[model samples]
Structure formats: structure tokens, C-alpha cells
Target: MFIQSQPADPAIHDKALRIANETLFIIRCLMREEEWGDYLREAYIIARRILEEKP
Candidate 1:
């Protein structure tokens, strides 16, 4: 959804996805399952809001 707002920019899309994945990986490695769940949910909310924002 976030990529859809951009003008066919693969670099931006790739970077955003990379960041999201890296964040998830780090959280998984460093956090307890219960605590990480909340952080993961918050990350998803932030991503969703970014996608929902108007240009």
C-alpha cells in the first residue's frame, strides 16, 4: 500500500520492506514473545498509517 502511493519507485519500496523485515527480525531476536507482540502490532499500525496517508 505504501508503495502504491509512490511513482513506480522500486528503491523506495525495497528499502521500506527491508526496514520492516529487519525490525521484525531484531524484535524476534531480542524480545520475549509477549513483549514483542505489542511492538510488532505497533509497527504494523505505523506501516498502515503510512500507507493510508495522502500525498
Candidate 2:
């Protein structure tokens, strides 16, 4: 989702994709256990941070 909003810079785009993918992967793991409330929220916060940090 966030990946689609990335800029044209290959480096920043790649970094955003990687961060989003890793965050989603962790969320998926939590979802498997049906225990992702706080974790998912944290993941979104981190995603926003990733977006802010990108150039």
C-alpha cells in the first residue's frame, strides 16, 4: 500500500518497500496468532516514520 506512494528515487523507494514489507511480515505473524493489536499499531507508526524519513 505505502509502497505505491513512494517517490521515483530508486534508493528511497527500495528502502520504503523493504521497511513496509518487513512491517507487514511481522503483522502477518501476529495475525496468525490473533494477537496483533498493539503490534499492528506500532507497525503503522513505524511505517509513518519510514515515510517521514524518506527523501
Candidate 3:
């Protein structure tokens, strides 16, 4: 017997995609490590919290 996975809900997928894109943008900005030290640290913490809380 074989099992099949259910497709993701469109709304949830869109929300996850948006969050991922925003996180990627944050990471890109964070690559400028010198100028973004404290800001990057805060953003990282916030991102972590958001990801941890995600369903």
C-alpha cells in the first residue's frame, strides 16, 4: 500500500512564501555585517521568534 501527502492550503502557502521572502530580504541586508550589527541582531531574534511561532 502507498500513502499520499495532502497538498498545502493555498492561503497558508502564500503566507509562508511571503514570510520566507521577507526573511530572505532581511538576511541580505544582514550580510552587510559592519553597518548592521545591532539591527541585524534584533532582526535575527525577531525572525527566530516568528519562525518558532509559525504553524
Which candidate number would show the highest TM-score if scored against the true structure? 1
Question: For model 3, what is the alpha-carbon lDDT of residue 30?
Answer: 47
List the lowest-lDDT window of 10 residues for candidate 3.
1-10
Query: Which of the two, 1 or 3, has more lDDT?
Result: 1
lDDT tens per residue, model 2, 1-55 = 3443544456655665566667777557547545555555465556555665646
Each model's backbone clash number: 0, 0, 0
- Over 1-55, each residue of candidate 3 has an lDDT whose tens digit, in order, gives 1112433456644554566556657677546656455554455445444544546
Identify the runs in model 1 with alpha carbons over 4 angstroms from their true place.
1-22
TM-score of 2: 0.42
TM-scores, each model vs. reference: 0.50, 0.42, 0.42
Off by over 4 Å in 2: 1-6, 30-55
| TM-score of model number 1 | 0.50
Q: Where is model 3 more than 4 Å wrong at Cα?
A: 1-5, 30-55
Residue-by-residue lDDT tens digits, candidate 1, 1-55 = 5543445346544554555666888768777777766775566556555655679
